[model samples]
Target: MKKIFFARPYRFIFFPLAAAAFLSLISFIVMHLWNYLLPGLLHVDMITFWQAMALFVLCKILFGFGGRGKFGGGAPCMRQKMEERLKHMSPEEQQRFKEQFSNRMCHKSGHWGRRDWFGEEAKQEDKKAD
Candidate 1:
């Protein structure tokens, strides 16, 4: 069983099957409890309840395995990879990178610094305006 789980070909099928079984079991217990508590809350018969439970399980499997592209799917994002690389850098390298990034951004946006917004330069401009 462990070997089957570790096998590449079986893994894809195994994960969704396991997830669906787990979810279905939980759903079944919840539904049973709800039925016991309210009896006829939704007027749901056994057949209809089972159908709804199966549908819920199917949706869980599809969204969990298919939606996120986790099961050997989807192209990975470059920005995420770059951010991971940056995070692994030394503290000195990080500070240098941050300085370069801020300088570039400030140059592009024509901002001197955060304090420059309301400091002596802006105060002088305001006095001249008055």
Candidate 2:
């Protein structure tokens, strides 16, 4: 209808042009930075604009750009789902689940925040106090 014609330019031309311009700006900055810094400091050869664009793509593929996921923030959704599932678990089931999860997970100190991993240790201390 009328909407189709109105949106066609945005779908076809405007978005593509905008993407190209933004990518070009990033590539230009990368190119200038490499040209200015590396050749003088490390004796590495300078790269062209297209080469810089390719490098940007390569780094994105290898290291990822760390954007939000399709469902928005990923870990929050996962944690909420986990908590929901855990709420339905029996006491024995919760113990078994905790054992299974803690055994599989080996986090370094200070890596994760505010989680009680050793309730069994506290229970043992209570037995000693009695």
Candidate 3:
């Protein structure tokens, strides 16, 4: 008779054990760095190991999980939607739409020092015309 080996039971135990070990090591590094640097440099109190772990968790919460945001890939999805909409428009309509959008963006405030999308020479010609 052959015996069947079950890998699933081992996987469940291994992953949590690995994660806990990683978190412990990271937290220990955080505690030592904070205790070594901040107290003397910033005149702040040194944190305990648990406090370091909490600080790491707090940072992960406040900033993100290392993507653009919580949901991720926002800009690419928006670009795809815009491309789908543009595909249905005729050439003339697309040109008109692009011109209107470009004009609105160029005239808006707080865009100083950025090169025009049309290029530097076109911008100089526009300045000369004005």
- Per-candidate Cα lDDT values, in order, are 0.65, 0.79, 0.79
Q: Which is the better candidate, 1 or 2, if ranked by lDDT?
A: 2
TM-score of each: 0.30, 0.48, 0.48
lDDT of 3 by residue, 1-130 (tens): 2232363467668889999999999999999999999999999998999999999989989987765553435588887887898899999978966785566555644345454466555788899999
Q: Whose TM-score is higher: candidate 1's or candidate 3's?
A: 3
**Candidate 2 stretches greater than 4 Å from native:** 1-8, 70-130
| List of clashing residue pairs for candidate 3 | none
Compose the digit string of candidate 1's lDDT tens values, residues 11-35: 7987899988887787787666666
Question: Could you tell me the lDDT of residue 26 within candidate 2?
Answer: 94
Roughly what TM-score does model 1 have, to 2 decimal places? 0.30
Better of 1 and 2 by TM-score: 2
lDDT of 2 by residue, 6-122 (tens): 766567777889999999999999999999999999999999999999998899999878876544555787889878989999989888887856644444344353334554565
